[model samples]
Target: MPVTTDLVQQVLRLANEVNAFAKQCGRADLSQTLVEVAARWKETETTIVVAGAQKRGKSRLINALVGRPGLLPVDADVATNCHLTLRRGPVLSATVHRNDGDVEIDPEQIADYASTTGDPAKRRDVLGVDVTMDHPLLDGVRLLDTPGVDSLTLGHRQATVAILQRADALLFALSAQDQPVLRHELEFLAEAMERVQAVAFVLTKVEDSANAQALLEENRRRLATFVADAGRSSPGTAAALAPLLEAPWLPVSAKLAEAAAAQRSLGREDRAAKLQERSGMGPLEDYIRACAGGRELTRSATVVSACVSVLSSLTAVAEDDVASASEDGAEAARRLAEVDKALEELTRTMRDRRRHAVGNQFLGREVSAIVRARLARVRQPYEQAISELGTRAALERYLAQLPESVEQSIRAAWDDIVAEVSRLVGRALNEFLAALGLEPMEMDLAKLSMPTVWSHELQSEPGESAKLDLLREGVPAATMAVTIGMALAHLNPIGFLIGPAIAAAVMSRRREWEQVHRNQAALRRLVSEQFTQAAGEITLALEREVASWRVAVEETADIALAGQRKELEARRAELRAPAGRSAADRGQARRRAADRLARAGELTERALALRGEIGPAVNALA
Candidate 1:
């Protein structure tokens, strides 16, 4: 397997073990961090941004780099408006970012959305374009073709500057026909070098200039001089650009490279190989691959360093706790008793505080008031709609929409409750930590609260069986009574026919009105029940999080005390032994202490070894 693959596998294995350990130790926060770090390592990709001034053939160079001609638009007006991101996929796909949301478009239509030239109204909303191709060159590497740094359009310049901030490496393209190093290019490079991990200068359009070699050499010298001069004013900029300044400049004809790729695709291998050699794109491609490999190594090292630091700190803390507990005789016993008392008192106080916070009538009232206010905003419109419903079909339609409306209202109310509860829990935890004379642990209550899962459960659509039950039980009883009364009051034609018909119609409306009210009342009850359940669940989760935090703190002290007690007990047992007066007994105790110290030394050596491994990985990037 490749080094990248081997390194990733090692990292994932370590992360899994650490995550399990963290959970066992009740360190969910640390476990979550490890999980996220593993995920980031898995998704890591080397991103290169090709940026330069207008008409410098940046897009052409990118297309040639990927060995896919016309993959990116080459026209100046079309290519210089917005940033284009190219990556690998199974098939060609493109999406345009707009103010509303992303819109998928045909790969051929990318130029229209990315350009500002054709139909201003049609492309006005487009923010950027992302394209994915099936080219092997794009695997594990993404290329961003940015707008010209010195474009006449201010937006293009700003967008390029912004994109530079996120680029892992920058390929600065300069036209061979232009001066070796312009002031604008120098300024952009200075800013970009500070933000990106690596930088390289490319002298483009070499076919158009007979003195391309001279331009490349002269530009390299100019860059070195610029860095030397900038060091006097800004040492940081000089240091950041040192790698690029030491690297050689690459000069290539993007047109020739594109022609080579096209010819190869047409089966003209001989002509294509000659054109590719003259284009000098191979050296540039090799340099990019080296930079990408270096970046991956550096990134892996950084993540490993972080993980090692966390684990090492935890181990050191644990060892210190054990050492502190293994003290001698009566003094150790006294310390243990004191710690036990403090832990007991702290536990009691914390429990009381949690109960007070959760069971507080004031908090419940505040939550209820807010929920009611949100519900009231939707209730009026819902009631009006129900009242205006005229026929059985209309009533059925209204009933069908009722659950969704009620769910929306409940969700909104639940969101407010969650925010408020998080604030309360945070405040309570802070107070408890203060009482224990310890700094508060950083906690994200919202994340730990499991809001999404709870919300989904609470907002599930009500069953059709329940809806039918409400209609059947509440509507027909009143309607039947009214029909019987109307039949008995009528005898003549007017009273018998028209009166009964009017009465029956009125009674049906009344029954529907009652059923609608009943349904609303039932919905209100269901919302209240969900709110109470959510509150209880949140309260319990908060208690567990705080309790776990408290346990970790106490466990440290407890471990220390336990070690001391064990040492004291061992001494007592030795003193009571038949050979208590012998020198061999003293020798045994000394050997035990020495063995413990040796174990501690071993742990320290392992930590140092882990730290030592990171340095070479980082240096390999240079």
Candidate 2:
């Protein structure tokens, strides 16, 4: 049976009950872990991103998917430059985020902020668009419409790639007119396969093309070969793409689907049914629903596994405490000493391990080398360009393009740092857990939600501003005009006698050269400063994350010890009770202990049963 939210809720309810029982037993630490696991289940949702090449009918496909004919704006001349995220809400609303700030826009005006040709100001700075509506299809799913991958614009490609990396699943739209996938599409898909959890292809505009099935089959075969080729170069990509190779290739006509949905709304049932059948949209919808359900099931399985691990550890600790408490004083002391010794040794070993992992591998010389190398590479091109420019116009053009180059270099360096930190932290965590005698859990750094280092606020320094002001103030309009006229006059034989004019022009050129050099130096310094600040912030965040993980490991040990000590004290008090106590009093104490053990056993059984019920589905989806 397919895993459902109801099934997950049933498991969550069981966990909550077990948590309450733990609290009643004075095991708050165990209960806290269970609470966190339950929260993970609650926040699980499937995110799907729709992407394709330019003019591939992406917006239309999205509109059809939601059964809304005019929800997203589509045009032949205008291409979407920003991401459009759709989710369920009580009323429809649109929010546009730009470099300056965010603004509330009417839903009908989304194209103004999302498309390339909507508003001139918006087209220059718009970042993304968010739309909310009361649509049933969006209840537990977030759909993102991204700019085309093969867009001529570089920013559009970068935005699409970033979104694809963060998405849970991807719906890669292909137009039937474009028979085989383009090279850029394959490259994007190869990279995306390594990041996203699932992917499926949709061949759009079937109505406009002949032999849609033949096109779909041919594309499928080519994709399979592409996956195989990618696997040869990158085994990880191959593994990630394995399951997707079997995913359904849906051929759909968004135009037909939209018309059919509209007809159904108008109560033309017969016409609607026929159009829907011809559009082949029903199977596509079913495929999306199944994938969404599968993603949820996989997420639930992860939470369940974590919960079970914690509960099992708590159970073992409790059992050990009870057994130790019933023993004589000498035996109890010996066991306590052994535990203390083991913990102390493990603590020392972990401290050294963390120093090596975080201090040396993460934030140490290796990362510093990465930053230095990137900074050098970033400065090389700009330095060369600045030095080679002989005229003011050339310098102005170089400055105009410098900011983008700096931003891209900084973002790339930050990405490398984050990836390295994540790798080191994962290794450290696994080692730390192993030292604590627990099973190692695989960690996905992408899922950790690390912050990005890129911020729009970083710009040219005050010194750089002064250099620019000097350049503008010193270079007079007449001097520039004279310089242009001198070049034109030099082409004539009579211009050779104008030595003084040539001399004045040479002097002006010398001054301009000096000003350009100063400006170049200032710009380089500004970029270096920005890089330093961003690298520092990323390092600090990573250090904090590592520190938190260490604290959690130590806290887990302390909590177990506190619980055990409390249980031991209670047992000792019972033993020290006066002989005058009635026989029924001792009998009651024994009965209470038995009841507690029985309840623990029952809870354990129930947890295992739930795992058994959901395990197969989780494995299949994963």
Candidates in order: C-alpha RMSD to true structure: 21.5, 15.3
C-alpha lDDT values of all predictions: 0.60, 0.64
| Per-residue alpha-carbon lDDT of candidate 2 for residues 409-471, written as tens digits (9 for 90 to 100) | 766656666676557655766675565454444332332333465445335432322233345
lDDT for predicted candidate 1 compared with the true structure: 0.60
The C-alpha stretches of model 2 lying farther than 4 A from their native spots are 1-44, 76-81, 298-622
Which pairs clash in the backbone of model 2? Answer: none
Error of 2 at 299 (Å): 4.5
TM-score of each: 0.43, 0.43
Candidate 1 minimal-lDDT segment of 10 residues? 444-453
Clashing residue pairs in candidate 1, if any?
Answer: 325-560, 325-563, 325-564
Error of 2 at 454 (Å): 47
* Cα lDDT of model 1 by residue, 496-538, tens digit: 4455466557655766666655555544455455555544554
